[model samples]
Target: MSDRNGNPQDPDNGPESPHRLIEARLQKMAELGESVELYPYGFDRSHTSEQMRADEKSLTEAETKVRYPGRIMAKRGTGKTLFVPVQDERGTVQAYFRKDDLGDEAFHRVQKLMDIGDWVGVEGKLFRTRTGELSIHVEDFTFLSKAIRPLPEKYHDMSLENRCRRRYLDLAMNQESRERFRRRSEIIAEIRAFFAEEEFLEVETPVLQSLYGGATARPFKTHHNALDMTLYLRIADELYLKRLIVGGLEKVYEIAKDFRNEGMDRTHNPEFTMLECYAAYWDYHDMMDLMERLMRRLARGISADGKLKYGEVELDFSQPFGRIRFMDALQDKTGRDLMAADDEEVAAVAREHGITLKKGMGRDKILDELFSELVEPGLVQPTFVMDHPKELSPLAKAHRETEGLVERFEMFVAGFELSNSFSELNDPREQRERFVAQKALLEAGDEEAQQLDEDFLQAMEQGMPPTGGMGIGIDRLVMLLVDSNNIRDVLLFPHMRPEQS
Candidate 1:
């Protein structure tokens, strides 16, 4: 059924649904118009549920002094007494109402005005119930805000798609959802604290860029009306952070939101958070140690034992992380030396693994697909896959010991790439050649190609020190740490397709 506004309604709840409940609530507001201000300015809450619980033993049950506010989540009893679970940010407590204490007229008025989703401030004293539940005995109550529309039904109309689209409902109804987001916030704070202690300057980079480079991914594009030039949402923070390195900022990091014109999956999102860090005079080896320490710290910070369970896989961060050269690991998985393989041989490997690439994608791209299919999943524990092909790492410095590889390491965990680091490419001429090669790939139909940003090249020419730069997908890391299955599970506002009308 359609509403008066021409919006779709749930077929299962034709009339006695959220729509009818909202209509009933609107009528209640109309009836109580002259008697109450349903939407009050504010409530001066003296104690949160947590504070009340902390002082649970000190406060007298007979005395009434505390002013507490929370949303009425659940209600019980239809007679002269009512028990409702009131939830604040920290936790929930029960509010006990008696008609004798409030009188019949006021009590009946409350029954008329209050609903499960309404916010209320209670003037009450802490007490222990007959069942020993910590609760509040109300002397007086004030309506804070009326929830005109009821919450989604517990079992119906609360699908995953609906939850993502209407996160407010999900958060209100699901405590796990609320706590997961809180954990996300706390994890981020811990990261900032860690960086600060290590003396890395937390910095912000431009989200809107004239040219996007630093990653092999397409960027979201826009045009600025005032400037009248095209602007692309940044896909990586590596280039700008390296520019700061050129400016002689020894250590810099940015916790940034990067936008990518990409596919969405359980692990991938179009828009995501990234923690990019760069330090001068450090190589990928140093970065490997830093990442391992950071991960160990973060894992222990969230998990008490530095061990985590993601799905059925148990990851012990307390153990030393495994490391392997990228090409060697691929050869072990494929039983062929991919580096020595010709185009036809590599194409055969790709076909064997059920991999399909864009028509003109480079050999390295094909190799990456094959590894992603065969090797990435078995890298269940924390593992460093090091020294990728120079063709694959356009921004990484060439491997000093190897002929055609770059000093790069990608950290993988729980079947996903968690972080990537490089001994940043600093030679201006070499960097130019790398960009030229990437341009050739771009023209050959590889859409995820780096653009030659002259401005950045000039920064490099002015002299950038030997620097190690790393980018960690904050969402993906949060997922592994929190055991959240989907990218949307960790993100409060994950990108979603529009609801069908």
Candidate 2:
């Protein structure tokens, strides 16, 4: 069988194949009138070697007489006897083959037809090798599928750039990637259970909204052929979850896909999952308490002591998270009081910090850029950076004492923003004014600005109760739980540019 690039005889290049050779080989087999194998074939044993390793007791020969199915990863030796490494979803196990046992015709067929990467089901007796390595002694085997291309050799050192580019092969060879995803599934289950225990009803919302009003990010737009109208993929589920609150649902949440038309990075993706929930009659502080508790619970599920080793530091999620005001962080880091700084004074501060500001740029934009550059990276531990500038937060309630600030708190962990919470503004008049301000920003050429959602305003006009709401970055959380350094590692199928044909 040939590899993707047509040189099937070449083993070193097999792992990087795009299945071109494999597909071509299958077509050739069809022309040769060779029938493909079927699955759900009878098997006495289904336990994989990896599963067996995790089991409490040892498996006996009588138990090993069962059948196991998996893909053949490697083959060694030749002629009468051979050793093969077979991998299933759970793990890999060694299989021993003898020429005498199969007889001459069967042995010839095995030598000619069987190739690495082929899916095979084997019925075997269980035994330990002379070296005490657990193995399956094959009595009969069936071709589950023929694989033309060989897999990459794991012994050689290759660049990670190549591994990421050909992730399917990487997944085939790497155990760590598989384990991380297993942990990711566990993390999601634990969080889902936590929300269910809290009596929060998980709900779904429209992904395509008429007006993409939620967070301050650019949105991917699409056109419907039937109606010939523009629609946008949601940037956040914030507005929909809050609408559920207005519908008299006390607590509502949604963990679903959100699309943002933004730049890709190690920490950013054009499309990602956003977990948003809202509870009536609760404030930002209450949300903070619940948020931290939930995080600690998730951490406990992922780690032995409710703590994780990130880099050289151990981040303990067991204790109460610290709270600091936005202005306080700015003053501490930059030695300038953001509350007292006027336009001219803030402009000078920005200039000193090498920040350029446009004409008519407000205090909020200046302060935000400054904080993101200086203050955000240093917040390694879990911290609630609260009371943000009013211009930056249109949906949050006004700060109790600060005139131009809002009651919002963003939780940062491991130098990444994990969650954003706020006491939602419910007054119809105030909501209308906020939307107008956002509309003005959009008109002024801020494409990232939010559009005015009249329908959402009408929902508020129905006298919606004051509420607490939050948006958590599920990918970032999974990254922390799985100890994954890059965002792409946690994602099953990360976005990638199409390789040149």
Candidate 3:
């Protein structure tokens, strides 16, 4: 058949064939309604496929009737009996349908109208097939929902781009993908449970704010119609969560959606989930212990021996994660003391490393570029790179022993910085100075620099106790736990470019 443009649009052979298949399914739907009560949708399910399988050994054929709802995954047999595989959220089970049991009319209707990808309510009893596979013997059935379009062929091995673009189809057709998301949920639940057990209250903060600070990231701006003011999607919940600490809600955490108007990559998503937690009386040292415990807990939840394998690397979370001072590691890697280097020296070092220097780049930015390019990628094991230069950690408390350094650490694993923690700077005067410095960076063309939030400063002036704050990239953590190489793998719907029409 030809398309609207009169081109040779092979409806049977070309890209438009899927539309033809949809039309065929729609026609079947219309025909099926002629004889039977189509009851195209229902949710009265007695047992999921997994539950039925678990209870299969105890269930006797024709004695324990079961009502299950699932999508038809595959079909076989052509004569009086048919074996179809049906998949629910939990798992898949083979269902045996006999013409004698279902009645000739219903069997004929199913034979003519039922298609793979259609949702069906199956009333059956547990039975073992001739091949000894556990299955359901169909007594009666109902067509739950019609799937007009066919699922992708070999969906489990489909290209990443297509899989992400049609995530619902991916979830429907790919059991591994569904299980990965299920594990993601389990991990998040465990994390919440861990925090709650530690007496930390799970709290929520604003996603939209009049002013954005807390993290060094570009903000996504929006306008509040009622207030007639510009609002920004929060890049981090750090400042606000700390304000709660000041208000005597000492132990608090938030698992929230943080937006950064930034580039996307294997580890970075523009919109991502972050777990930001704060403890009023704690410091960075305490945070390090908490982080280690948390990682071990997550690792144990996934693997019994507190070990997790990401790609080819097996990480031992039970072992104490290694720690090296940030400047020491930078110098060890680059043979240059970044803390002692002036801007000219840092710029020269950056040039030596073949790093691109942005216009108006300061010493800290130069040092950061050098570390990311030369040092970060080699951090394969679980390690804490600690004691950052003050210039790189404005929100962190200055190190008591080190003159120009702050008590901050970034936990790195498999070359990805999973979490950042700081012995938070609670001195209002010092915080104002840091904000002023950040403002200077903002003026000097650093769009990702932290903003000077006067309100947060005022809250600080109201006397917040010494606190430790940590922010974890939950997406990156999930990627590590699930052995997913890309951040997009964990995210249900990551940001993507506009599809060509």
Per-residue lDDT tens digits for candidate 2, residues 1-501, read 132344545443444653565656555445432534433355455677766565414556246465777788877866687777778776887778888898875565455557787777777777777877666777887767666665777697445655666677777777777778778888877888988998889999999888897899989899888999999999989888888889999988888989998889988777888889899999999899989989999888767588888876778898889899999998998898868988888778878888878876788898998888888988888899999999999989998788988999999988889999999999989989999999999999999888898999999899888899999999999988777778888887777765431
Among all candidates shown, the one with the greatest lDDT: 1
Model 3 ranges off by over 4 Å: 1-18, 39-43, 336-343
Give residue 156's lDDT in candidate 3 (0 to 100): 44
Q: Which regions of candidate 1 deviate over 4 angstroms?
A: 1-19, 60-64, 155-157, 342-344, 348-358
Q: Which whole-number lDDT from 0 to 100 does residue 177 have in model 3?
A: 89
- Write candidate 1's Cα lDDT for 81-178 as tens digits: 98888888788888999998999877876776688898989888889899988788999998888888787676555788778878998888887888
Query: For residue 439, what is the lDDT in candidate 3?
Result: 90
10 residues in a row with least lDDT, candidate 1: 1-10
Candidate 3, pairs of clashing residues: 40-144
Clash pairs for candidate 1: none
Q: What is the TM-score of each candidate against the true structure?
A: 0.93, 0.91, 0.93
Answer with 2 or 3, whichever has the higher TM-score.
3
